[model samples]
Target: MRPVRGRWLSWLVGIAVALGFAVSALAQDEGYCGDEGVWLQILGSGGSELTDQRSAASYLVWIDDTARLMVDAGSGAALRFDETGADMAGLDAIVFTHLGAATTADLPALLEGSVDAGRKGLLPVFGPSGNDLRPAIGDFVERLIGANGAYSELSSFLTFRNAAGYKLSVREVSATGQRRWSRFSSDVLKLSAIPVHHGGIPALAWRVEIGEYVIVFAGSFSNQRDRVANFAKGADALVVSHAAPEAARGELREYHAIPSQLGRVAARAEARILVLGNRTSRTLGRESQSREAIEQHFTGPLVFANELECWGLPDKEDELP
Candidate 1:
């Protein structure tokens, strides 16, 4: 009986040791667990141009492994989001930079995907109110999920607590005339927006703060350099869309920021990291030139984002685990 007890204890100890190693392996491979820090995942990194290699603009902001917010739902973002193995049911809000197809076409896919993933209750959505050329975010949601809208059946199919649950509560930020402004805040996060010139369309740049860390999304801005710099002041990470090259002129200049412009914004904002997103085939191979242009003014870490890449922010030692 003594020998049998000794064998049992040995087996138990071996099992515990193996389990510990397994947990450590998981933490190392994923980096999502055991790390108390903010993370940014690029879902889609391309622009309006459809390529087999890349998707349009979308990003997921995760706080301690739980997805807190989604920024821009561009083409193919849903699939990229799925590949990240994140819980869509945990998403708190969806913020759109602008209503362009490259920036917002995959919203329905995300809505449907979330419902399929057991998302319940209201999904808060925030975006810029439209001008004559575009539809406001509220109007856009109604068009997609209203009584007779395109995906109206979603309301019937996805419900919780015996009621229509998969609903969107839309908040439209109207900074039509304002240069820089803030609108949304909660206990854990604060959201701010500023009007950005994206050709003739109504566009916005967004900044999100979680604890001591700050992330600024310089969404598709052109020529509002000072406003963007002010809005992104001292951000930890600056996400800028590389829409066109520095030499682009005329009407093209009104729509997108060149590489040098993006670098200048990051430098002036005092950002630690610059993520160059919204890449196209034209700008894919010219990374060195872009980096050179950026280095001329900004001396920060530059990352050319791709789909499903996860970036871990610097951990604050004083924060609670």
Candidate 2:
């Protein structure tokens, strides 16, 4: 192992995750992973860039042992999802941040797996409305499985006639600026969505409250309108996209949050910990510079994420940083 040193250590998680860990060594001997608490595993952490090897953005949320939620399903996500030994039948919902292919390209392939797994319950799918450039999520799913769609045979997922004993309940949340949609509320889980601007891409950010743990997936947004801070307030873990480097401009700045803005968002929301994912080749080797940029406005632990890394809250109250 390399020798531990400097302030950079503080920016990384030292919790000893088999998947990924921050370097801070927050004095946690055993990280909260696998406990009764809520844990988040990144299935795919990279952007849709063809030059990179990392899978597209995907996430798996585990409550105890069963995977309860899947945040996004970008391309190459299915392979990583299956690697975690999680079954689709156990998922409570598969929520999308937007209709972008980087966030939904793996839907057909993932749903195709459900046929073999024989899921027996309602799998709720959530996403945002669309514009002329992008199809609304309902139309998006229908195009994949409707009677005259590409995968017409799989239309059973939209109906109740399949012997598989399961059905998909897909809902498109409002994409109006700063709007809120209380999508689901139950004893086991509670979910809320807020419209966020992704350069007119029609996106929404999501918050999932499982038991007492709160997780926020900011998705891929520029936060130019600043809807994320209030929507993500007081989260245990906030996952944001820092897909571009410090010097990026133009379209890159429009589609994703820059490093400095990422700091302000997490800090303003008072998120206990901030996780950086949805990486790209441009941002991969610039962690040091990004860390410097974020530290200007945020003092909390800043975690740079890797694929399949499971992050959990500290098991004991005192273990939290």
Give TM-scores for every candidate, taking all chains together and pairing residue i with residue i.
0.83, 0.89
Any residue pairs clashing in model 1, and if so which?
none
lDDT of 1 by residue, 1-321 (tens): 000001111222234345642111121122232134677777887887756378997888778667788999888888877776667677778898888788878877776666556667777788888988889988877777666778886545323432334666688988487655676676678888888888878888889999898998887888554588878898877898886876677887788888888888888888777888888876777777887888898875666776666666644332211
| Candidate 1: regions farther than 4 A off | 1-35, 155-164, 315-321
Per residue, candidate 2 scores C-alpha lDDT tens digits across 166-276 of 899988898885558995965577999998878878888999987777899999889888989999998888999979898989998888889999999999999888888
Candidate 2, residue 92: CA error in Å?
A: 0.9
Backbone collisions counted per model:
0, 5
Q: Where does candidate 2 have its weakest 10-residue lDDT segment?
A: 1-10
lDDT, residue 96, model 1? 86
* Residue 46, model 1: Cα distance from true site in angstroms: 0.8
Model 2 deviation from the true structure expressed as Cα RMSD, one decimal place: 5.2
Measured by TM-score, how close is model 2 to the native structure?
A: 0.89
